[model samples]
Target: MSEEVGRTAQSGWEVGVSRTLPYSGARLWEFLLGREGVEVWLGAGVELPRERGEAYETANGITGEIRSFHEGTRVRLTWRPKDWDHDSTLQLTVVGQGRRSTLKFHQEWLADAAERAEQRAYWKDVTERVAAALAER
Candidate 1:
């Protein structure tokens, strides 16, 4: 069988979504890592730790462990909702050039195409929420 659009030999099914905003990378990074923004994108009522191997669970019961974190640039973690049977890797990156910044969300290790599609929609919605919040600033 031919591999699907987001399927990879190493990571399995995956999805990625991004949004560019009219803010500097530094500004976007600050907001993305800030408490309010973190709750929006990451989860509600959880402060993501900077150290790798740190585990966290949101107020809503989604759990994850930080795999890597680069100050002001990116973070990688393993995420698993309470209902999920396995963990997936998620990476968020902020790329800034001049006055604009691009926020990227990538997830891999999805179970199948359905999971990939679901995550794609989920990330798109997340980007929209993030964008809307920034636009209000």
Candidate 2:
């Protein structure tokens, strides 16, 4: 599911998407944090450290800094496409037990309603792709 909260001007807007997958949190976390796993959904290679304040770049030209990291559970980062004027904050939370998992993703600090809507659609598609990839694994 997906949702958007608050006005774009007041708090930069917030967009969230969630998905349930047939994988463990550790598995999903690897996909989200590991370079090989990122390539599956993002269509790019990412160079990132698992520590705060480290820079990361994707082959698709997206760049950001790691804001926070909690191994096998959560990651927060600053995300900016090559064309965006500024960066946005994105947080990914994984909750899972055994072989089932739920991923909650939030991206805030968007520029406007348009950007929020755009990202909502973008993430929905991306997360769906992620789910499909996990299923194949």
- Using TM-score as the measure, the top candidate is 1
Question: Model 1 clash pairs?
Answer: none
TM-score of 2: 0.87
Give Cα-based local distance difference scores for all models.
0.93, 0.81
After superposition, the stretches of candidate 1 with alpha carbons farther than 4 Å from their true spots are none
How large is the C-alpha RMSD of every model relative to the true structure? Answer: 0.8, 3.7
**Candidate 1: count of backbone clashes, pairs at least 3 residues apart or interchain:** 0
lDDT string for model 2 (31-134, tens) is 87676666754448775568899988888888898899888888888889899999999888899878988988889988878988998898898888788877
lDDT of 1 at 127: 93
In the range 19-133, model 1's lDDT, one tens digit per residue, is 8889999999999899989998889989999999999999988899999999989999999988999999999999998899999999999999998999999999999999888
